[model samples]
Structure formats: structure tokens, C-alpha cells
Target: MMRRQFFLLPLMINALMACLAMALTNITTDQHALLAFKSQLKLDPSHILSKNWSVSFPTGKWIGVTCSPRHQRVSALDVSGMRLSGNLPSQLGNLSFLASLNLSSNSFHGQLPKELAQLHRLRYLDFRLNGLTGDIPFWLGLLVELRFLNLRNNSFTGTIPSSITNMSKLQVLDLSNNPLQGNIPEAVGSLFNFYP
Candidate 1:
């Protein structure tokens, strides 16, 4: 009996360690995503992400990070009013669990990345007051969970993609202040409470 117990103890310990490792990987991936954003986007030298990003603690303690208790990974990133300038990186799409991303009131330029469509869990995306240009990617409609989308005050041009109407859960849609032309697609009315 003593010999059997010893063997079982090691197995249990190994399993516990595996679970802990998996949790740590998730946290690391989430943090890496935020770091990638900081590197790709030109941020104001006066205001920057926390330098102590290696420490583990409540996400609220970290600048621009928000996490949920159920899953200790980052859920939201609000970097508004930071006076940031630069183009977004395509690598941002790697964040599979991001829910809200707010980078408003910055000076970011370049075309909106098609990679952004990969954020399946994203619900709120605000890129307002930037210099982003080009057609709205059709893949954006694939974000079925999206509820709030604001791309206002940008240099975006071209007809709004008809696929945007597929965002059935969307409650607020603000594309005003861009150079977009052409009649608004009829399907846009389908979004429950979408407003200009």
C-alpha cells in the first residue's frame, strides 16, 4: 500500500504542474499581445506602458490592461488620449481572446489591417480620430460578437462593405467623419440599434 501511494503522488503532482503551466502560457500570450501593440504603434514618449510588465499581479495594476476573474488573461485595452502615432501591426490579430480594444484620439495612420478580423471575441473596437484609410475590410462582418464599432474621424474611403450588416449584435456603429461615399447599404438597417 505504501509503494502504491508513492507512485500515485508523483502522477498527481505532474498533472497539477501541467495545469499551472498552461495557465502561465495563457497569461504570457496575453501580455505579449499587448507588448506587440506598444512596439508596433508609436506611443507618446511621455506616456507609455508600464515598465514592470514582467511581474504578475492584478491586471488593474498594469497600465491599459483589464482582466476578468474567471480567466486571468487580459480582456480589454484602453489606450485613448495617449497621443499615439503610427500604424497598427498585423500581428494584433494574434490576440484570440481580446474583447475590447480602444485606441481612439491618436495619430495612427495606414490601412486598417485585414488581420483584425481574426479577433473573434472582440465586442468593442474603437479606432476613432486616427488617420486610417482604405476600404473597410469585408471580414469585419465576420465578428458576429461585435457590439460597438467606432471608426469615425479617419481618412477611410470607398463604399462601406455590405457585409457590415452581418454584425447583428451591433448596437452602436459610428463611421461618420471619414471620406467614405456611396449610399449606405440597405442591409445596415438590420443591425438592431446601429446609428450613424
Candidate 2:
């Protein structure tokens, strides 16, 4: 019995260490994605993230960053209205655990990076008041967890894709003030039961 207990104790310790290593890897991955995003910005007038994103600050303590308590992975990033200008980088797709993101009221331009569709866990996204162009990517429908999406006042053209109906979890979808034409999809009825 003594020998059996000794072996089992080491096994448990090794398993615990492996889990800690994985958690650390996840935290580092989130930091790398955030740093990659900062590198692409043309300007950060408020110096929010630019000044605060450092290892010494801890991933969860960084400005506009929020991490999952259990996994220690960035889950929400809200950096709205800091007069930032830059193209959205594909590296953002690396934040696999991201659930809520808000980059509204910035001057970001160019097409939305297709890599954004990699965020399968995303629940809330607000990119309003930017200069983003191109048609809203139909791939957004693949984000089955998405709930609130606000793309108001952007330069996006073309009609909303019918694939958007696949967002059965979507509760509030704001696509107002774009150059979009054509009628809303009929399948949208499944999303909201009441509408005024």
C-alpha cells in the first residue's frame, strides 16, 4: 500500500504540472495576438493598449483586455473610440477564446479580414463607425455563438447575406446606416419572434 500511494502521488503531481503548462501557453498566445494587433495600428491617440500592453501588466490587467478566470485566456477586448487607425490584422484570429470584441468609433479601414471568421466562440462584436469597406462576409454566419452584432455607420456595400440567418443565437443585429440595399432575409424571422 505504501508503494502504491507513492507512485500515485507523483502521477497526480505530473498531471497537475501539465495542466499548469497548458494554461500558461494559452495566456502567452493571447498576448502574442494582442501584440500583433498593436503592431499594425497606424496610430493610437489614447495610448490605451499601446502603453499598457506589457508582460509586467499581466494579460488580464492590460487595458481593454479581459481574460477567462479559469483558462486565463483573453475573452473580451473593448477598445472603442480611441481614434485608432489601422487595418484589422488576421492575427486576431489567434484569440480562439474571444467572446466579446468592440472596436467601434475608430478609423479602421479596408476589408474585414477573413481570418476573423476563425473566432468560433465569439458572442458579441461591435465594429461600428469605422471606415471598413467590402461586403459583409457571409462567413460570419459560421459563428454560431454570436449574439449581438453592431456594424452601424460603416462603408460596407452590397446586401446582407442570407447566410446571416444561420446565426440563430443572434439577438441584436444592427446593420443600419451602411450602403446596403435589398430586402432583409425571410429566414430572419427565426431569429426574432417580435419586431416593430
Best candidate, lDDT-wise?
2
Clash pairs of candidate 2?
Answer: none
How far residue 137's Cα lies from its native spot in candidate 1, in Å, is 0.8
Task: Report lDDT (CA) for all predictions.
Answer: 0.83, 0.89
Q: How close is candidate 2 to the true structure, as a TM-score?
A: 0.87
Q: Give one digit per residue, the lDDT tens place, for model 2 in 116-148.
A: 999999999999999999998999889888888
What's the true lDDT of residue 140 in model 2?
Answer: 89
Which candidate number maximizes TM-score?
2
Per-candidate TM-scores read 0.84, 0.87
For 105-177, candidate 1 gives per-residue lDDT tens digits of 9898998778889899999999999888888888999999999999999998999999998899999999999
